[model samples]
Target: MEVYSERQRISNAVEVLKERQLTVGLVPTMGALHEGHLALVRRALDDNDIVVVSVFVNPTQFDNQDDLEKYPRTLKHDVALLEEVDRERILVYAPSVEDIYEGNTISQKFDFDGLEYEMEGKFRSGHFDGVGTIVKRFFEIIKPHKAYFGEKDFQQLQIIKKLVEKNNIPVAIIGCEIYRETNGLAMSSRNVRLKPEYKEVAPFIYKTLLAAKDKFGIESASEVVKWVESQFSKQDLLRLEYFIIADTNTLKPVEEKTNKKSYRAFIAVYADDIRLIDNIALN
Candidate 1:
């Protein structure tokens, strides 16, 4: 794999690829290699002639300094996995923060308005703005025919889709399925931070959402909330942040008997400081 750290070199390489009439696929990531991330890379490889995976731990996205500091950085392992995927066709761009941002430090803020104030947004204020800024920059730089993102971050996928549509970005944004473990816990890079005991209980987050889906038939939103809350309350180790069953698209809170075309149960909890988020679809 050809590794480029500077923008000029990467741009030149992309130009060379374009000269050969190759369709480029970009998989933007923050550098901790996991099966979920690999799923995105594999999808990109299948759809495009050339695949470029950029690994830059974006500093702006994290609201907590400690979280950012502790965020996993396994560049060595990450590249090894990518190389195994397709060494000849894959290009790894691991740029420094300064190289990616330069003096263009101003964040691209969104009035995502109501959409920005719930679930993940509520907890991580200005997070999507940071996500928007970096993603926009990456889109401009790569100018790929398509970009792949994981559905593990459903809200993030929605935000990126909105950004592309509203701004008229040309690249085709694709979202892959949420990769999960054998136990049903949605695969996440942050899963590494969970304590040994917490890891065992982590799958319950998924279980609770599954239960909520079946409970929906017999219970109201209020009742679901009560039951889920009690379930979490029983586990002293699990600190529930929000247990919401809302309109999957707009993410607005749903009331009793309000049926929608699509619905989702989103939950966020802190298992001893390792915050995990998961959602399940209720059709």
Candidate 2:
């Protein structure tokens, strides 16, 4: 439960841990701690001698300023949650924007071998760039041996893997399974912003994903898209933004299963102003 807002202090602390040859794990996050995030932390704790959960609401990732402002910042609550996880092994790094970006909060451009031009990238212009920038900065700052990421943002997870590959970063990147609610709705920080009515209907997104998963191998990938679209069309409360069955590796939308490659359904839906995204693997 030691929390550090200054980069230099945390860096120094991490350096000391490294000198002791203690294995360190990094769990990068944007505040608003949910069970989804804690799952990553708990796993990191299991795998490493120490876990550092960075809670900084990154500004560069948001294409819309309103969304950035509205994005929850709950470091105090987040720390409390981490303290509950394990007070001694978990170190919380809650940095300010100025502390993270050093006054200029602009994101760096990355190619990601055109991996950035897909689903989330197409919608949130500089989103992955911001993600890469911040995550890279954390890797530099923390220098952890292992890092954990949830598969909820499967595309982003792929991009991060590419980031490490491109830069030759030494850290091992781990993607954990998506944590869902008892009703099947994917756990998300944005779930806090869902309207009461929207909350009731939000579980439909996962229900449709489950059905789409069922149809993935049987139906054409394009047909699965159509079925998902029709299912969402019948619902008036939530709007389906985009749903594509993409290869688990390259993330290119496929019309039919080819070459024994794995595929997964990636979706983004709007519960009014709050956007929710989820994915499920299709084999």
Candidate 3:
């Protein structure tokens, strides 16, 4: 895999690739890659002639300084994993903070309005803006024919799709499935932070959502919420952040009157300060 730390080198490499008429696929990621991230790379490799993965821990996306500080960084392992996937076809661009955002000012910010203000957005203020800014920069730099994102971050995926449409960026945004472990817990880099006991119980998050989906059909939203809240309340080790069934597209609280429509049960919990997020769609 070719590694480029500077913008000029990356730009030149991309230009050469373009000159050769090779179709490019870009997978943008914050490092500490896991099976989920590799799944994305594998999919990209299948679809395009050249695969480029940008691993930069975006500073702007984190709402909490401690969370940002604690965010995992395993660059040596991440590169090894990429090379294992495909050494010849893969290109790794792992740049410094200064290299990415050269100037102090970033002009573009995507305002998703209602979409931005709900769910994860509500908890992490200006988080999506930071996501938008970095993603836009990466998109511009790579100029890939297609870009891939994992469906685990469904809301963020939706927002990026909207950004591409609104901005007229000429790249197809592809979302791959949420890769999980044997226990049904969605694969996430943050899973590394979990305590041994908490990691074992982590699969319960998915199980809870599955149970909640069944209850959604027969019960009111309030009842469902109460049941979910009680489930976490009883689990003394689990620190429930938010358990909500919201409009899949809007991420807003679905009214009881509108319960007939499709909804998604999204949950974020803290087990020993290692936050885990998961969601399940309901009809």
Best by lDDT: 2
Candidate order (lDDT):
2, 3, 1
Ranking by TM-score: 2, 1, 3
* After superposition, candidate 2 runs with Cα above 4 Å error: none
Our model 2 lands, by Cα RMSD against the true structure, at 0.8
Clashing pairs in 2: none
lDDT per model vs. reference? 0.87, 0.93, 0.87
**TM, every model:** 0.95, 0.98, 0.94
Looking at model 2, residue 232 earns an lDDT score of 89
Off by over 4 Å in 3: 103-108, 257-261
Per-residue lDDT value at 162 in model 3? 82
Backbone collisions counted per model: 0, 0, 0
lDDT string, candidate 2, 1-283, tens digits? 7999999999999999989999999999998999999999999999999999999999999999999889888888999999999999988898999999998989998989989999998899889999999999999999999999999999999999999999999999999999999989999999988889999999999999999989876889999999999988999988999999998888999866876898899999999999999999988
Which is the better candidate, 1 or 3, if ranked by TM-score?
Answer: 1
Local distance difference test, candidate 3: 0.87
